[model samples]
Target: MLDLVVLVSGGGTNLQAIIDAIDNGTITNARIRAVISNNQNAYALERARRHGIEAVCVSPKEYADRELFNQAFLDTVDAYQPGLIVLAGFLVVIPPAMIQKYEKKIINIHPSLIPSFCGTGYYGLKVHEAALTRGVKITGATVHYVDEGTDTGPILLQKAVEVREGDTPQELQRRVMEEAEWVILPEAIQLIANGRKEA
Candidate 1:
């Protein structure tokens, strides 16, 4: 089985989706080895523990500097021997060493369609707000390999959701999560689990 280690930094709604998919067999040939979070209080850890999956925290606060934290984080993840590292909503800029070590073995689910409201200073609700401000008729989510550059990896899957009239950023964010992120993230995982890189 492919051992997965999911990294999260928030409520972990996407992590929950992956767990549900695994439970229902939507994803096969793989299993979550652990859930790692940078936030000590992240609810994702609770979700993982509830499901009997190992949950760990490698917070930067525990270390002396960024370099030390980065090393500790990488070592913690490596200890799990994960075949795939999924970044569901991890906010930390991945250390360059980690990216170099894992390469295409790491994947991330971005809130926007990418090359648009992505890159630095764009994350979470900021993406939806930018999309709304730009008046884009369609906004979506993307799953891609994690590269050194922000959201500049090989695209795996993308699903677009329409921008509804008079929609608030919060509302649009919810819709995109439900319509696009929830669907394509798991689909990407399934594709990789089955030994296919494209879908």
Candidate 2:
């Protein structure tokens, strides 16, 4: 089985999608080993618990410095021996050491198609707002391997969602999650899982 360690920051809609996909057999030969969150009160923890998956929190606030927190985070993740690490709306910038250790084994689901409204200071509704501000009609979501640079990893899957007229950022975000993020994230996971099995 392909073991996954999913990281989340806020409400875990993407995490929910993964759980549902696994339960429904859309993503086979894989199971979530644990769900880790930076926020102690993240609802994602509850979601993981509901599914009987191990849930943990390794907050930066608990540590004295970023270095300490990063080590704790890395140690926590490594303990799970995850085959794949999935960033499902995880807002924290990944630690460089962890990235180096995991390499292409880590992946993220970005809200935008990437290379636009991505990189620094672009996340969540901000991406949708920027797309609206730029008047782009074709905004979407991307699933990519996690690299050292932000959203600069090799692309795995992308699905476009229409930016409708008079669509608010919240509305656009919702649609993108439903149409693109939800679909592609699970698909990407399955692709990776199947590839490992084949190999």
Candidate 3:
């Protein structure tokens, strides 16, 4: 089994999806070694706890700067010795500290088709808002390898969600999560487990 360390910043529906998929055999040969987060009160930690997995909060506010926090965060995750580091909902980026060691071992799930409503400052509902503003009829979620640039990683899988009339950002966000994000994220994990490394 591959050890996994999942990172999150908020409600961990994707994390929960991973947990459920593992339980149901949709994702096999991988176990969640830990869940790490920047927010102490993030519900993701609780989800990890419910699964009897280790949960740690390396709050950025506890550190003096981003660089320091990045070091501490990487240190904590490294302790888990995960073969795969999944960014389910993680917000921060660990560059100089982790980019080299983890490399393609890390993966992230984005709320849009990527290259469309993704990049720096485009996350959470902001992605849906951008797609709505652009009047796009189709938006989706993407699961990809984690690289240095924002959402610039090699894509593993993507599933499109239809944009309906009179859709709010919140509605679009929910639809994308239900229709695209939850499904493809776990499927991508399974594909990665089977050694599908193509972009």
Which number leads on lDDT? 2
Worst 10 residues of 1 by lDDT: 190-199
- The count of residue-pair clashes in candidate 2 stands at 0
**TM-score versus the correct structure, for each prediction:** 0.98, 0.98, 0.97
**lDDT tens digits, residues 1-199, model 2?**
8999999999999999999999999999899999999998999999999999999999999999999999999999999999999999999989999999998899999989887789988998899999999999899999999889989998888899999999999999999999999999999999999994221
- Over 124-191, each residue of candidate 3 has an lDDT whose tens digit, in order, gives 99999999999999999999888888899888889999999999999999999999999999898887
**Model 1 collision count:** 0
Better of 1 and 3 by TM-score: 1
Q: What is the lDDT of residue 26 in candidate 3?
A: 97
Better lDDT candidate (1, 3): 1
Clashing residue pairs in candidate 1, if any? Answer: none
Scored by lDDT, model 3 comes in at: 0.90
For every model shown, the clashing-pair count is: 0, 0, 0
Mark the regions of model 2 whose C-alpha exceeds 4 Å error after superposition.
196-199
Which sequence of candidate numbers ranks them by lDDT, best first?
A: 2, 1, 3
Question: lDDT tens string, model 1, 1-199?
Answer: 7889999999999999999999999999889999999999999999999999999999999999999999999999999988899999999999999998998899999988877898989899999999999999999999999889989999888889999999999999999999999999888899888988732
